[model samples]
Target: MTTHVYFDGGTKNGTTRIDPPFDGDLYFQAGLFDKEERYLRTDEIQVVDGVTYTVFRFTA
Candidate 1:
């Protein structure tokens, strides 16, 4: 099955939203973890309509 993954999808109303959804699973090392420790940093998976999305947030 094909998965729709979105990177740096951005936020909406303080919540992550899938903007310009991608066709497949795409990911990178950056914007995924912290510098000190390799900890997966992201928000809860949200289901909008019937689509489920795993949104990641970068730390400042």
Candidate 2:
């Protein structure tokens, strides 16, 4: 059996913040992509209020 986990980007579960490197590393370790799969160049990474996040898209 194989288990796959993905960090959809942005916060985790709409509360705690999830950052790159950590999340990205997970994907890489899992044999996926090493970095964010898809995101907007214009948006890049943004810090709203006090939370930092990146807007990414999961394509099917």
Candidate 3:
């Protein structure tokens, strides 16, 4: 069995999409960029046709 993992893939405008492994901890990663916790935003999970992928976006 093989697991799927996606790094920083896909982007547009100022948002970067990342399909993290096993839907890993995103809050932690966002914390890294949001030291001051000013504005933390993420897009809705998107799935590609015929594939199971949890996609979301975060601004850096």
In model 3, the worst 10-residue window by lDDT is: 1-10
- Candidate 2, 1-60: lDDT as tens digits: 112232344332122234334334222212244433432212334455665555343332
Q: What TM-score does candidate 3 get on C-alpha atoms?
A: 0.28
Quality of model 3 by C-alpha lDDT: 0.33
Candidate 2 runs further than 4 Å off: 1-43
Tell me model 2's lDDT, rounded to 2 decimals: 0.34
Model 3, 1-60: lDDT tens digits are: 112322233233233334434434342233344442122223434345544433333335
TM-score rank order: 1, 3, 2
Report the Cα RMSD per candidate.
8.1, 10.5, 7.6
Q: For candidate 1, write residues 5-50 as lDDT tens digits.
A: 3234333223443345443333333344423312123555656567
Pairs in steric clash, model 2: none
- What's the C-alpha lDDT at position 2 in model 3? 12
